[model samples]
Target chain A: MDILLEMLEKDARLTPEQIAIMTQKDEGDIKAAIDSYESRGVILGYKALVNWDKTEREYISAIIELKVTPQRDRGFEKIAEKIYNYPEVKSLYLMSGAYDFQVILEGKTLREVAQFVASKLAPIDGVISTATHFVLKKYKDNGCVFKVPEKDERINSI
Target chain B: MTDYSKKLSKTAQSISPSGIRKFFDILDDMDDVTSLTVGQPDFATPWHIREAAIDALSAGKTYYTSNAGLTPLREEISKYVKRRFSLDYGKDEIITTVGGSEAIDLAMRALIDPGDEVIIPVPSFVCYGPIARLAGGVPVYVDLDEKDGFTLTPEKLERAITPKTKLLVLPFPNNPTGSVMRLPELEKIADIIEKKDIFVLSDEIYAELTYKGRHVSIASLDGMRERTIIASGFSKAYAMTGWRLGYTLAPREISVQMLKIHQYAIMCAPTASQYAGIEALCAGDEDIEYMKAEYDRRRLYIVNCLRSAGFECYEPLGAFYVFPNISKYGLDSESFCSRLLYENKVAIVPGTAFGSCGEGFARISYAYSVKHISSAVEKLADFANKIKNERKL
Candidate 1:
């Protein structure tokens, strides 16, 4: 595994110099490698993982599963493009079972998400049905756990 | 209440309290201290292995196992030792211990007679000397040189041996020093042991964490198998310290003797832990590699950090600690550690806690995240500057 990518995935704020010392690499080489990774699209944008429940932010997120009928030649890709273009759509994945698409979306309120699902999502051609499930809590995401692990209760010992 | 002092065994009374005890109490009261004082792995037992124990509990495997252990666990342990270290031990030759502590105790009690001698390399773990004394054996400390990377050479071993020397406690990929004895080094020690009428208790708890090369067991060398009993556990290897699972592999005759002690004393290791041990030995190789790689990165990073701060640090070849030379700072190991804790809020173990020979050095554990290490090193560098400045006066 490329330790540079691994470190950046864990904490993108680490400077090239710090990564060089951690990985025992030349700082110049680290910077060059990172630059190439960024150019090659392997290095995506870095963002903070925030818990909105702990903040003053007012929003609700929902997973809207849509059953789609594939257009004769276009298949599910055309429907995926139409759903993902909306500003409220945070993430979308083509599904394997029971449903044709899984759409993770955010809206200002429960009513907003329901309205989008009912009026906007349901009216789309080749979309058979929709089910929206609200996310009540997030214990973990992207390998970053939200719960502060039980404070290391280990006593100092041999 | 019962006049315990007068009635207690003299050897037990002679053992002093740990030197690190006071600092630990103070650390508990003080918040926001980034301490590198832990001797166990920082990672939790991987979840799948824990789930196996949960399954075992659900299945009601609650009865006491055989005196040695569950047959399946012993078989797994036997297969594991053979697969990893190339030391073949049948299921009949292994005994499940409460922890490596109990296994070491078992080895000491089963082998040492009254007034027999046990050769111990100093600056190792704190348990052996006291355990030997409790078993009515004399503890002979062999001080290893820091310049030698704290390895016990053949000459050192030879000098420590005596007519009554009945046992040698060989702990390597050592805890405080992190010095691992490779095959060639083991070969030298084996040559000397081949001549002597002595037994060996090889404590290899940190065997899987050898970063430089594979760890060589003395038991694997020629003619040493019958004489060496390997004491190891799941604590260091699989991060299962809280589970209290360990085992010992010995020659058939010696194992029979050790099993008698374990059967009488412990009855058996925790039944659920034995079940978990089976899962760990069979499925935890990837966990070992993953944790070892994490330690290796922190090892390199912490060594670089300590060296850059102007401390004379020994680059450890194994284990998760960096034993740095702090004698030049005009303070003893305890003083250096306390000053660093109070002044800089970074807590590392003084080397002397391992043995008197660990004086003038401190063991900094790298079993932590890189972020934690870097933050602590930042304060340590500041503290080093303060010491250097004061010395100029």
Candidate 2:
């Protein structure tokens, strides 16, 4: 099962016959492995990457460092529940020290972020202070980096 | 919560909320706003082009066109490419789309596989990344330098590519910044792309509206024809935004794939619009020249006005926008834009809405008439004076 999972992860595009050949297993075994993985919810889904910089729609992203006081019995989970509930919060993380949590919110403009800070998160009970940092540059994310080869690298190295 | 809400894919839910639309919504409800916030050309469709659409309707040519678009229109587009930028593409390689928007959509859908990396330069058109994601590709952004007139240097391009890089969206004749790439600039890009086996989505929608030397296509360079998809439309040139006609020229295999997706999603671009497009290609030269001249006039007027008013205005060499640096006002782009709209009744899009690099600037469109341009500039100048006085700058 581990070998099967490894092969599938390496190349999702590999055909069953190809996977079987690579794994030294029967095609039936490869097919069953894929089916079981799907049934067990291991291979969730596929997605596309969009170059928003070139498109017509606008994109704004910000990481909001949230300072919160944990409730007695509910602890930080209760505060996290409120922060993550908003649809604008793309990602939320419970952290250690300094900041209690970090929430990534995406909106159309700075005003929208300001509004969210004032109206939504700040007003929530037990929520302390929040500092928002807009992402200035995204050098790498989701296993993709935007870097072309140097002229020498392009010429000499593959 | 509704059960139907669960059916939405993560991608669908992840669509970046539109910054422009959000502001526009606010401006819409406000009665006193004089808006320059829109990215579209304020010019109406040229009379000759409109006549062509009217003629098409009169002649009862209001049926669906071939999925790829009318042959004559495609042929004219092919000729337009050659005559304008020395790029050669046959009618077979062209797909007429709903708009340049759709052309971009089709290109991404056709080329991007899941997890493929697409390089996008900022601050630029906002649609590229979202559309790429919808097509199962990841968008990686490279910030273009303001010091370099927002032009994407070969150094920047090289630093932005990776092993997973599958597509690079070249949005020159850029929005917000109004930068353009010349032949020498394109050659550097061509050199890098030749070895990478990556596809290029060259969005030259504002190709005809350039104020600098003629627009050049990277695809025209050696070995680039096969690797680049040229997406353009008559929207800016013929003032045909409402017509909803744009096209993409690519290698035949890619065109075929794009057409397959386009056919499934959009049966055909508007039929009358295609005929009008043919007319636009065949006889819209005078209209193009007239509108270009008008835009040039407003461009000069606005730039001069902004500069004389103590704003650091970047002279946009292409597109119909003047992105002026408003940092001295000590207000962020969003605050500056909103306050301008509220106080002076003049609306401009915040540069921050374009990208992070767009902070400290505001995009003011000169696509309006000279009269509106003068009035808006006067109001803007007064607003700037007020801010400077209050802030003691």
Candidate with the greatest DockQ versus the true structure: 1
For A1-158, candidate 1 gives per-residue lDDT tens digits of 28789889988888888888878789999999998999999997889988787888898999999998999998988998999999999999998989989999999899999999998899999999998899998888889789755777677875
- Candidate 2, residues A1-158, lDDT tens digits: the string is 77566545544555676556434478798898788889999976544544555567777789988887789999988888888989999889998889988898888887898889889998888887989898876776565554552221111000
For candidate 2, the TM-score is 0.70
- lDDT per residue for candidate 2 within B1-393, as digits (tens), equals 677658888898888787667777777778756667666766667777788888999999878888998888999999988887788899999999999999999999999889999999999988998999999999999888778889989899888889999999999899878889888888988888987788899999999988747888888889999999989998888888778999999999999999999999998999889988988888888887767766775676678667877889877999988889988899999999889888889988898888888899888887665556767888999999999999998
Candidate 1 is scored at a TM of 0.96
Each prediction's TM-score versus the true structure: 0.96, 0.70
For model 2, the stretches where C-alpha displacement exceeds 4 angstroms are A1-158
Question: Runs in model 1 with CA error above 4 Å?
Answer: A69-74, B1-3
Best by TM-score: 1
* Per-residue C-alpha lDDT of model 1 across residues B12-61, encoded as one tens digit per residue: 89988777788889988988898888888899999989999999999998
Candidate 2 chain B has its poorest 10 consecutive residues by lDDT at: B32-41
